[model samples]
Target: MKDKTIDYLLRATWIAVAKMYNEEASKKGSTMATGFALLNIDPEEGTPSTSLGPKMGMEATSLSRTLRSMEDKGLIVRKKNPEDGRSVLIQLTDFGKEMRIFSKQVVLKFDEAVHREINQEDLDTFSRVAQTIMDLINNKKIYKKQIPSK
Candidate 1:
């Protein structure tokens, strides 16, 4: 059936992508997560865990732990917001910015590979489909990672 075919293709694509990611960064963890968070956050305004959760689809507590781990990694530093002491703003450390720059290469490679794999028509269709899926899932927020339970 068409539904089954679509499901199979989607699952296969996901597995392939995940496998590629694992191979590319076997030791991936806080660094990548921090990079993603840094990417979504405002470069100047910064952002807080409460504002970041909806984007990453993670719970606030989960985002907090992830930020703590990244802080321990020295990838980011959190400061209590001066305007609102109740909130904390996150900023990437110098090391994190360097790491993010390096990781951009990985993203570039992924983009090149994707472009090579799909034709123009397919790419357009994919863009639309992906957007539709995200719209269904994201609730107008950005992307984020879930903090693994300890």
Candidate 2:
């Protein structure tokens, strides 16, 4: 098979795995961590909206939309940036903080289970392969560069 075909297979596999997790996660929107990396970010540091996109594997527009939705859900609040009136500052609400904690536990168990199945050498190999995949996605902004790119 061609390299592109292989790449497509890999992409399909990733989508399948993600969908499996998301299906499980749908029960508690954000509680099971369907999109944990995107959701659980650094605590409210008075950060700018534009800056968070690249740091969190997001684009400004998508992040804005997500933030707006989360805002409507009372999970976050956005204020006009004092330093730059043109931009918005984001901070999680009390509800979001609590949810972050709960989602983190789910993430931890997921990580532990995946890690437990692999030995050290294979773990290193897996990390390297995953990083390579991420590098490809990051440089290309593949599929919009949302969350870990892996």
Candidate 3:
């Protein structure tokens, strides 16, 4: 990692985390994207299909495919939104709820492990720094000027 840039470190760390989640998801006969969608969905009330893509930061086509796969796995069902006849709602099945709990536990275990290893002040600073980076990217501040390559 000598001479590595911040962007390089960010990408590497994210890839490692994603790989870990993917491996865990594979053991449960699911994918990380499905688990993420499950976690975002409301347990009691169904989530609107239209909003799922933005909520997951996923493209509509990708989300549609994942939702279809979940439906095929008997993990979820799509119902017409009663409030808005033009919209559809995505609701988790019993099995989906079970998987959601599994996803939650996986996240909690990772969080607990990190918490145990890092001091509160360090963790808080890391959180702030990460959020700052996200905010900068979201606001398009990081790419305002083109970089000169070596």
Candidate 4:
């Protein structure tokens, strides 16, 4: 290819961002996945174990591993949901709350830096483009089955 494609650009940018986040998280002895999960969990009301996977766009197995690590770190506790007998709630401990704050600050700092560097109009266009890509993927419009002519 003579030039990079849209997907390539998006993938490269996201990879860089993920690496940056992981580096920052490592300084505090955490991973980006853990920080992301912490941010997704509700502080006041515990989140449902089943819902956490979907909410964080994580697979059940991966989410389970991360949750287990968090539990081992004494960052979170799993309590049986009083409202539902079959489900459990993932509640953060004081330590989890503290880490969540740190994660939030890291995300906010990145956002602030981007905003300072990019104008609002460019940011808006970038958001719209990203959303459009998401919509296409979510709607399954990008890849459809086609029958071959005999």
RMSD of each: 8.0, 7.4, 3.7, 1.9
List, residue by residue over 17-116, the lDDT tens digit for candidate 2: 6776676566567422224533545566646777777767666677777777777777777889899999887777787777666666656776798789
Q: Candidate 1: lDDT over CA atoms?
A: 0.72
Candidate 3 C-alpha lDDT tens digits along 16-129:
989999999999999889999999999889899998889899998999999999999999999999999999999999999999999988889889999999999999999999
TM-score per candidate, chains pooled: 0.71, 0.71, 0.92, 0.95
Task: Let me know the TM-score candidate 1 reaches against the reference structure.
Answer: 0.71
Record all residue pairs in model 1 with backbone atoms less than 3 Å apart, i.e. clashing.
55-142, 56-144
State the lDDT at 74 in candidate 1: 85
Report clash pairs, candidate 3.
none
Residue 93 lDDT (model 1):
79
lDDT of 4 by residue, 108-145 (tens): 99999999999999999999999999999998899976
- Return the clash pairs for model 4, or none: none
- The model with the greater lDDT, 2 or 4, is 4
lDDT of 1 at 87: 81
Q: What is the lDDT of every predicted structure here? A: 0.72, 0.69, 0.94, 0.96
- Give the runs in model 2 whose Cα sits over 4 Å from its true position: 1-5, 31-34, 37-40, 133-150
Candidate of highest lDDT:
4
Candidate 3 residues lying further than 4 Å off, grouped into runs, are 145-150
